[model samples]
Target: MISSPERGGTVSTPTLRQILRDQLAPADPRILCGHDRLDVPVRWVHSSEIYEIGPLLTGGELLLTTGLGLRGLDGGTRKHYVHDLAERGVAAVAFEVGRTFDEVPDEMVRAGSAARLPIIELRSVVPFIDVCRAVNTSIAAREVDELRMRALLDDALHDDLAAGAGVAPMLGHLADLLDAPVVLVTAAGALVSAHGVDDDSAAWRVVDRAVAEVPVRSRGRSLARLVVGERAGAPTVPYAEALLRAAAGPVSVGLTRAGVRGSALAARLVEDLVDGRPLRRADLETRLAGAGVTVGGPSVLVPLAAEAPDPRMADAAVAAAAFDSMARSIVDATVYALVSVPVGGPGDVDPVERVASGLARSTGLGRTTIVVGDPVGIDRSRPGADASRTLTDSLRRCARQLGLAASAVSPAGAGRRVHTAREMLVDEAIGTLEPSVRAELSALAAPLAAHDERASTELVRTLAVHLAHGCSATRSAEVLHIGRQSLYQRLERIRVVLGFDPTEPSVYASMMVALRSLAAGA
Candidate 1:
């Protein structure tokens, strides 16, 4: 399921005939072979060499071939050859009428049609290169559109995170750009999000059918499907699929940042519809409710951090490698980690926190400090912005209280450490204790809370770690990324303030207790 990023999603390109039809006119473009009228986009043309083409064409191409070089060309030879192509799932067979095969033989056509294979017979002498160019040009144009759409989507989606414009409005923005209606459907083919479609429209039906066709699959369960709507007879552009796939990563990213923006927006719109407002909510509810989730309810917000800080690493490569290793490990475990820059750094605009939160619930982490706030009530919908603000404030306060540089919020059950740490931090005395030691020994170490600042905490913790490592000053210096002289100065500062040498064996026992006490208090 997880391929290289480049090959992650299939790029559907317009077929040769389809390209010609789109470029020329939507006239009576006859189907000689395959589903002629079907809008099969040409991903790319395959080489004439049989071995070379086999891998490139994956069950969908309007193969335009003139039986030029078949190893054997006897009675049933060509017929069997065409049959093989049909079995390979080529969308259509476009045989040039004037070539060696001349007109497509009735037997070949009959055999192909019997296999439900689309066949096209080129009446006029169109160059094979012309067909290739047509398809290529169409693909290039569509690629340009796709790229433009992705860029515009990223720009529009930024607001969803920053301004808290729930899922509906965000999807609406996408629909507007594509000039098509949008329907956010649930797994059982229910329409939860409807933008640009009104009641008594055939567009809704198309959306419903499409949703049934493309079931949602995320985190080992199918929860919802996204269906794009167009007019009654409008072509079912794979453009929508392209839009969905391309938009998914960033949308997921934004949703993580904003926390339940999609579900919250849907809830608000549902309430509006249920209350006899202008929107049509019941129809949407009927569609989405079948997905096995209540149309209205409370949901907790959670965030997953891709990597934790390793004080041992000094270089960027090591830090990045750590994050990548953690991300790969976690994503495989049904969790998606969003990497972020460490807090308190200048201009660290990492999207890790937001992305983690958006993909939080899917990760199935119970709850912790990483996941802040409460399960927002959805029985009667309110603006998502309010809930988001509450969550942000809660997280900010927790971070300040805990002195944590970075963290991720998961559901309460999964992120219990965060909850415990936050609970510990709320104690007034614990907040002033040496950061790590006090946090760990919050209750017992309250009496030894000599200096409250971070510098004091670091000095004590550094001295403790060094002493614990068999008093190897060199190893301690390496871990702290400081010189021996600096380490000594830090130890001296600790001795002066705390009245005990960290290096002394007799003082070690007392220091351990003090550190543990400070941690419990925190």
Candidate 2:
């Protein structure tokens, strides 16, 4: 039997054509059938007389045997044997004629032709051991060549790392080696770096095909994914998998270093603005311009809140870089950006919404809240001026709204109501009502709160559900997953505890406001 290299390494056995054309084997090996499949690779060589050998194969085998096992077998049995070998993906069947039958069986030839399984006839002069030796020698030569190529690739990557070259050079080198496009992306699918490709190309079709994705990790956490597209006339599958595995480590190191440096720069800039530090207008403008943001004219402050924290800000950075906006993380779960709206631009095109949509698509954060503030000029000379203060206040208010939205089971109902600048400002003002007024509102729900705390009852939730369903017992019961009798009993208990008329309009309005105020942490 031919000895093959270990699986999942940069080595592959020779194909069927190589074995026939090379001088290592006997001079006149003949293909009896299925000549079209001469290029299939021969993974191994096996010799067996057992007819039930289909269960023993792992595919891509060149099987050799004599006709001893098929001496008394009928025509149907002979055809069945060849069909079984074909179904098991045996690369080719080589039979020696002198051992049993005078010539090859016609039934076996027709079955091999039908299944497209290459059938080769070996003359009496060539021993079976010679065939095995030739195949093994070819596999050994392939392994040696793979070792040399792998060394060259490793040295190239080492040189890049030593020279402080960034991710682009690494990816470009990898693309040249594979002869196909390569892309690096965050876990959320934001593009980090790409080489030898464009956004619109047929190579992107490989993203949805049998893609080879390798994870890039740092400090025990995954930072990004390296994707290698399929190349035409590439090596075997195991060799490709090994190559990707080799490339992932250095790519991860480069990405992590670059990400840390970028995050530090962005954090300092954002922290200064949030804390209202004094700075020259020219300096601010220069920094913003470097990031592709034009802040000389009118600009709007856009605050974005995510349901979870993205520590590296990789997704947001990609989105911001794409739209030529300035983005920085203000908190663990919130980021703020400034986007320019051209003067005399069409009113119908809302730049804030466009930025928000782009970020949502990139970050894959479905419940993100994007709040837009009124336009303010960056030319204001004084630190903590009215314009800067307003922008900062709007950011804080937007952050509060995000927290409120995340706590609710369904944020789409009330969270979506705070869209415009005026609505956000009004909500902020209303949220800061006098302590005495808040206390007065709190008294409206004191009874239900006490009962819920003491008896572990759902009185507050029941009241909210009842009010939400327009005080309809039937509808509320369905929503609460309780029977009609149980819902009525709970409503009667609520009325008794509050000492109020159950159907009074004035009482209902007061209780609704009190519930909202308590939920808002008033």
Clashes of each: 57, 0
Local accuracy of candidate 1 as per-residue lDDT tens digits, 1-522: 111112223334665555547532322235654454356545654325242243456776666665565434554765676677666777666665555665667777777777777666656665566666766676677677677766777677676656755456666766765556666543322334566677524546756455222434444544445566653344444456766765554444432232221234333432232222432334433433432234343323222322111111111211232331111111110111112223335664333343333334333332222312222222235433343333234433433332231221111121232232232333434346567656445433333344546344565456546755667889888877889998887777767765556567766655554553444333
Candidate 2: what lDDT? 0.63
**Candidate 1 weakest lDDT stretch, 10 residues:** 325-334
Best by lDDT: 2
Candidate 2 structure, TM-score to reference? 0.42
Off by over 4 Å in 1: 1-56, 97-99, 105-107, 162-165, 185-193, 197-218, 231-238, 248-522
lDDT string for model 2 (1-522, tens) is: 111133233445678888777632563667899899999988777778888888899899988887778888999999999999898999999887777877789889999999999888766556667778778776777767556556666777778778767567877766666556677755533345677676624434555553477887765656567777766555234355555667778776665443322345555655456556645666766665665556765564454433232323433443433555555543322455455555445664565565555554554333344444545456555555555455566555554554444334221134342243433443345468897887787788778878999999988778877886789888888877899999888989998998985457877767766766665556
Choose the strongest candidate by TM-score: 2
Q: For residue 186, what is the lDDT in candidate 2? A: 50
lDDT of each: 0.46, 0.63
